[model samples]
Target: MKITFTFILLNLCIFISAQNDSINDKVISYDDKIILRLNLDTNVDDYVISSKELNIKPRLELNNQINTSFGLDYKIISATVSFAPHFFPGNNNNLKGKSSFTSYNFRFFPKNIIQTLSYKNSKGYYISNTQDFVSNWQKGKDPYLTFPNLRIQSFGGSTSYIFNKDFSLKAIYYQKEWQKKSSGSFIPSLNYEYLIFSDNQNSVKSREHQLNLSFDAGYYYNYVITKHINIAPFAFAGLGKKWSSYKSDVTKDEREKQNYFTQNFGAGIHLGYNSERLFFGSKFNYSGNHYDDNGSNILQNNFYVLLFFGYRLDPPSKVKKVYEKFQDKIPVL
Candidate 1:
């Protein structure tokens, strides 16, 4: 009887081991697939504005941006780049307002560690009723001045560790620092500013410059909806310090140069479906950043929406070659 019992236990252990090995192999195959992604559609990038001195609360509104992105992915790494052009349909004579190279991110996953290198350009709307700021607004010719946009650019990298299949933590760092510029091409326009409040009303244009090094840590939880679908929700909050310089274009002089502390907090949700040969997802995020100087503050609430579809790129070459050979038979426009 003792020998029979020992034999049954040994067989059960072997069966469990085989099942675990099969699961690992399936996961590995999915991770190793090479995939291509196409962007379907998206809404205008929205921004919210607020101020302490103006008694105006923050509000979210769509901007005049049309954005598109292309991406490629594989087991070890993934890359994405986006271009956004500001457009106004009412003004047929007006040129495209500005072409913003939105974001570039390269992400890598090696076992439990996830690494990311990213560059981002963000825009925020500003509204003020103060006499000083309004005076500057009335003098400007750029239409963007009435709804001023703050352009902030940053290049940074982040690292994260997976504690388990359901949980992870991430930390971000920026070596170069975040900087602010006007809403134009790489080289700003002469009188492109929408608002400028200073001692001299002769402020032909103005640009706000910021130098900030920030750090943030966040937690993400992956909630499984099905074998192929999952939703990951995350939350984060951070603090940093920045040196700001407000510059007047004509005089080439700095109006206000000061250092202040800033705080940011946000949360987002990500939904995705994954298989061995295909992956697709969509994400929506909302964040608010604020900094105060004297009696006024620069506050921004930002929202991001992205949709992506990816499939394994291993197309049949023989079939493609046959189709290409007979392409001349098809009618052309």
Candidate 2:
């Protein structure tokens, strides 16, 4: 199923590319749309009091272009992530699992606000060794299924705006609700990002979609390192309420109700080769606290990473000199 879906998506993207029209005018116009690629990310960090080491998952991304307009564009982007980790503050060396996704970017602005109205999604899957808040010591085989179904997510759509190529604010005030069904391990009550980095090239391309600002609001930013290797790092802080399944034996207080209240922040980096017809490269991002429940809100403290190879449907322009053969061609009457 994965192989066939990939093939069909790829072919559709190629067909879009051939139909793209030129955009020499100030208002960028386009048609060619279809892109796909693979990504990987790995980390070796020690967290908690004793030492919590981890090895996260990899990502598979797909973006199929549909159309374009001034400060407005349309494309669908989907990603999948799977990870395995080991915690050891208690010295328990067991592995865990996780995954999620996002789709479509419907906005664009090269020199302006770069506002976006796109559909966003997220989800995570996990399984633990022994059920406990604190980690257990003593390295052993994978204990990743004891507390399986630690979390599950299903949410979509919301409007967003960028301040510049590197910064902006967003709101998904009318986004649908979804949450995880885990014990001590939960999200929204604990929200988080895959990674954060600079993407001046807007490589992720989720800046356009269908929606409005009704419920959730957020802030984001980007930074560029080099023209050829642009970095666009962003951060998000939001507020909303959803349904979450906490510990059954815990207090039934409304404060602990599975409502939506989040303060998440992370950014991503885009390192691609740009031209008149193509912008192909890799991306990555990170955050300090997984769900911010750890209590540290400093933007420059913790971080994560993602690395992928991406290509745009329309290739950028390449500087080429006028050759003798083409230059000598006779003019038509």
Candidate 3:
């Protein structure tokens, strides 16, 4: 009886040892510092910009463009490059002009610090009605005319610190160095054509330049509805400056340049489903800037909706070979 008991005890010990060895091997096989590649993301954003000086009411426009992004994820850094391809037929003459878009985003995550650097050259069509010079030529009564397409090229960066999983603080700066550009509408046929034209010029331009900087605290909470579905809601508020120049190409003397301090606030909600193979999401955000200038309050409201889809890809043979070469150099401790 003593010999049988000894045999059973030895067998149980060997079984536990083998199980521990298996767990250790599994942990050693995965390197937390490795990078992932071949991730593709598709995004579409519909943007609306409204200001009292631009239109009687804000016009919401579908950009009708697809933005493609390619990203790489390393240990604590992620970088992505995105571009919009203009291949589809467009009916808007304002967009028929030259256009280009390129964006670069870099994210750094080291413990509680999260920082992002972004540069973008975004070109889009904008419409504004001609100012009513004569009482008979009423502004806001006519159709929304298109002219002076906007090309906003900016370099900006933001830094955020995560206090916890659901809360963070952020600061952003854009166009620190003021750059000047022209935006406005072309000459349109109104009842007072003679009054609208000066020095035989048929076009009206507003030479504009601005700087934007803001700081805000944000709260985001995620609710998991299922294994693959989740929803997130977020809100933020901040203040910034909107220094703008409003001028006419024909009459430079009749220009107005003002430095206005603006307060901004925004909120959004995101709903998405994420899985190992595919990911999709939709988000809607509304942001507004309010300030007082010359005894009148000016507010610029911007609303946008984003739809995104992404796919995951396995490492190709060439990528695997490079990864193997990198692994071979690591010394076993």
Candidate 4:
């Protein structure tokens, strides 16, 4: 009887181990496969300055341009190149002004950590609230006050950690994996950025340099609707500090320094379908930032809708061999 009892206990242990492995296997991984993606998004940046004491508000916005991005993912790294195509309808409208935008971004996912780096450059802006300043401005016929020489550039990145081991952020973001069960995670991130803003107007060149740092606490939930469908919603809030330096060619007192406190919040939702080789998704996102500039309130905001489609293919033998050689030296790869 003692021997029979020991046998039963051993069998039970084996059964439980098999069940655990089965659950883990449901999360499909495409790490060995290469993925190519095409994305389209309406993501224009805008700035607003308002002063209650002066009863004045001015809004600056880029043209309504549609941006297209191409991305590639291999092993643990993902990279993307994005630009605004001139063939888009509103991009060629002279009423808004000639504008250009380009960006490059890369992301790495290793275990529970996510790392990102990016750079963006944009030129040209217009006063979106021209009606407020003009006496008899028509809605579609009148041209906006254009800033053809204005430009802005930024270099930024973020590092985030996921607390829940079962939740897969890459499943929703990069489409490199798929999660079978519904799960959520608390993700905390640290972000930093350096920005340059310059404009040459009326032959006077003015420039500003800024450094910003922020921390955010965010919650993301992946609700599995079916084996091939899911919807994810996320939100975050953060506080930050900005250090700024301003210089102008026209003024003898050319250097000025200022510091400001900033607050930001954002929320977004994504709906996606995933299959063995194909994945597609749509997302809607809104983000806003506020800071005080010399007693005047400055607000910058972005609202955009995005659509993406991607396909996975088998990696070539040469590519796999190269990655294997480096994987030992870099465990994260």
Candidate order, TM-score descending: 4, 1, 3, 2
User: Per-residue lDDT of 152-208 in model 1, one digit per residue for the tens?
Assistant: 565555444445431222111110001111111111100000112222234355566
- Tens digit of per-residue lDDT, candidate 2, span 173-289: 000100111011011112212221111122221111111112323333223334343433344444433233232222323223222233335444444443434444454555432
Better of 1 and 4 by lDDT: 4
Model 4 per-residue lDDT tens digits across residues 1-333: 233234434433333232111225547778778999999999889999998687758899888668999999997779999999999987777888989999999887655677777889999999988988888998799999999999999878777888987888889889988999999999998777788899999999999988887888999999999999999999999999988988998764768999999998999999999999999999999998899987799999999999999999999999998998997775546
Worst 10 residues of 1 by lDDT: 184-193
Model 3 clash pairs are none
Cα deviation of 189, candidate 3, in Å: 46
Local accuracy of candidate 3 as per-residue lDDT tens digits, 1-333? 233234434433333232111112111111123333232223332224444465454342223344556656533346778776566443233333344567887654433344465666655533332233233544435433332255455455554544442221110111000111111111111010000111112455544445455566565555556656656677777766655555566657776667867777777776666555555667677767677767556665656566656554565677667666764673110
* C-alpha positional error of residue 304 in candidate 3 after TM-score superposition, expressed in Å: 2.5
Q: For each predicted model, how many residue pairs clash, with residues at least 3 apart or on different chains? A: 1, 58, 0, 0
Model 2, position 327: C-alpha lDDT score: 29
Q: Which stretches of candidate 2 lie over 4 Å from their true place?
A: 1-30, 41-137, 142-145, 149-151, 163-227, 243-260, 287-304, 312-333
The order of the candidates by lDDT, greatest first, is 4, 1, 3, 2
Best by TM-score: 4
Reference-based TM-score, model 1: 0.58
Alpha-carbon TM-score of each model against the true structure: 0.58, 0.39, 0.56, 0.90
Task: Give residue 237's error in model 1 in angstroms.
Answer: 2.0
